[model samples]
Target: MKTSSRLEKAIKKLYVAFHANELNPECCKHCAVGNILNNTDSWKHLSNDHGSLELNYVGKVHQTLGRKFNGYSPLELLQIEATFLKACGYQLPLHHKNKKPKSSADKEALFNGLTAVMEYLCKLDNINNIMDYSKLFEFENEKPKYQLPY
Candidate 1:
């Protein structure tokens, strides 16, 4: 399946970050959206509060102008972060007192979060979820219907 260059680049970066143990939910520059934006915290300025979908004044202007940061709108970036944080068991707004997992660096939890974020990214691009494996279940007879790409 062909994906946009921007999407391809973003996915590759995220995959590398995940395997490198660089994906973090607590740090703004290491979160899902942060990684998508080249590990920068500038996207945080899009919203007044972390994990907020509501865009602030700066975000509003950017959205109004149809600006896209690394192929995603400011609102989309916020949504991505929120989705990632939620999947990682973080309470919204990302406050210290908010409910959170015992270990923020839990690999299993981080993997789950990355999977969710990747799926959401596909949705934003109006494409099939790359993480979906239902096609691998197809079978005409006893043999496998599809071969896994290597």
Candidate 2:
């Protein structure tokens, strides 16, 4: 998906904050742009403190090019991750409006795409959850294994 410049810049600022010790990396967990885009908790904290950093950059090529961000708490970062995951591709059965169910091939394609993207992000973070994302299709009970308590 083509991301807005604002969203892109906001994401970059969040990363820089982590690099500069201005923000705690642990708070953001997976700090990569892909992860941040896929996860909402990080975006929320960053946005709440920084005020729609993404929206601000939507109009400019380098909105957050060199700015420092502040005010993210650990819990907010976690929330961002959850939201991002949902946005990226966590399917909601209820949201399926069409009477037609997904074909096996379609299901495979969706699962494969989500797994591929998530696996890539995990690799960037050196996180060991690649298997988790890859196995999301077969993951029973629709429950995430590493369920961080809110």
Candidate 3:
């Protein structure tokens, strides 16, 4: 199935953020993107088997976005990765940190990339505003509290 152009653009923007090492948030255990990037097993397999990290990331993104938008095929994911990587001028194995943006350009790229991801997420959830994506994060963070049997 063909994804929308807007979704494609969002993916490209996210790839740029990933390439720039600007997407790692504090406590990757709570961040979808961070989990994919820091997966040692996946990286090891990728190195040994010549596997595609891009596909791995896309699969994680698809799962995180939920079953409502789980129609992407491996070929479509590869195409998205190819388009993004082709415009990148760096090598793989991106190194990320939690430091602030070093410059205006860095800040701009980060903002654009984050907005793109949020936009795509909102579309998936049928939300009207990008900011609404934050609610999803909040919901995820709020696991059901356990209590002693009354």
Candidate 4:
């Protein structure tokens, strides 16, 4: 499903929030920017047979949003991706550049990257404010070690 301009903007916001929080953005292997987005090195896989916590986190996000959309909607899937990355410490580097070409392909890449980043930040903000427990299911790691919500 093609993302609308508003959805793309939401992703960009996520990237900015992650950067402000000092995290770097990670990419999905299935996506266009997967090569540049940070890979899952800092995080651990809970179990080999169960497909790891990361996959489970993704699935949880899909399931949570799936109920609302009646399956994995593209935007919801991207939002879920962002949520996990945020929990796993995936953030957007302030110095990172949007090297997308002058085409829709570039737009899509930008949209995906930013979308994932933004949703994560949003969930974090919600959790910190005690407003939403929407992300509790997808969180795989312990609470931030030294980081405090500010």
Candidate 5:
């Protein structure tokens, strides 16, 4: 599937961050949107609260002005961060009293989070989920229902 240049770059950056153990849903500079924006914490200013999809005044102005950070709008960035945090076992609008993962470095949790983020990214690009494996289960009359084009 052909992906937009922005989507391609975002996926490559996220892949490296995931493998390098740099992805952290709680850190402004290491979250999904952060990594997609080159690990900068600037995106955090888009929202008054971390993991919030609602844009603040500054964010609203940017959104109205058609500003995009790394090909994503302020609201889109917030949504991406929220998606990552939720999949990483964090409750919405993260707070000190909110439920969280037992360990910060849980590989399974991180993998799940990344998978979810990747799916969301693909969805934003209007493409098939690259991580989908459901086709492997497709069968007809004891034969594979689908064949790999490659």
Candidate 6:
């Protein structure tokens, strides 16, 4: 199925953010942006299997975007993410693993890249005024829910 123009625009913005070095993969490992970039290398290789990873990433995006844009269910978000991945020549696998060592720089890159895409999405959905995406840069006094136990 063809993706909506809004989703397409969001995907394109993600690519632009990545190439512009706006994402930080390491810091955003658990974020939608970080997950997509880290899992698929910015969608460069079609062979990289995402499996449930796609759902996980898109779900994360939905958690934030959903608050702003109503009517989109989690399943719908998953479908959108899957469509986006397929358009980029990637597929969602049932299972997979990352054998390579984790790279902080790569993580940071993805995180930053996703942030830009998300910001654009918020603006597109008219949620920018409600939630300041820039707050992502601020260090919260409380630990983030996604913070690693280790």
In terms of lDDT, the best-performing candidate is 1
Candidate 2, 1-150: lDDT as tens digits: 343444445446544543443332122333323234433333433333221223323223223443222322333333333333333343321133423224322333333433443444444345554337454444446766454447
How much is 81 displaced in model 3, in angstroms? 8.4
In Å, residue 108's CA in model 4 sits off its true spot by: 20
Model 3 error, position 49 (Å): 12
- TM-score of every model versus the real structure: 0.94, 0.24, 0.30, 0.21, 0.93, 0.28
Model 1 clashes, total count? 0
Tell me the whole-model lDDT of each prediction, alpha carbons only: 0.90, 0.36, 0.38, 0.36, 0.88, 0.40
TM-score of 1: 0.94
Q: Each model's number of backbone clashes? A: 0, 13, 0, 8, 0, 19
Off by over 4 Å in 3: 1-32, 35-105, 132-150
Cα TM-score of candidate 2: 0.24
Runs in model 4 deviating more than 4 A are 1-6, 18-21, 24-65, 68-150
Better of 1 and 5 by TM-score: 1
Q: lDDT per residue, candidate 5, 1-150, as tens digits?
A: 799898899989989998999988888888888899999999888888888888989999999999989999888888888988899999988787889999767889988888998899899999999899899889999999989878
Clashing pairs in 1: none
lDDT (tens digit, per residue) of candidate 6 on 1-150? 244555555556456545665433222222233333343333212223332333355455555575322233444334434443333223343222433224423644344434444544455455543224455555556654344336
Error of 5 at 84 (Å): 0.6
- In candidate 5, position 142 carries an lDDT of 98
lDDT measured at residue 67 in model 4 versus the true structure, 0 to 100: 41
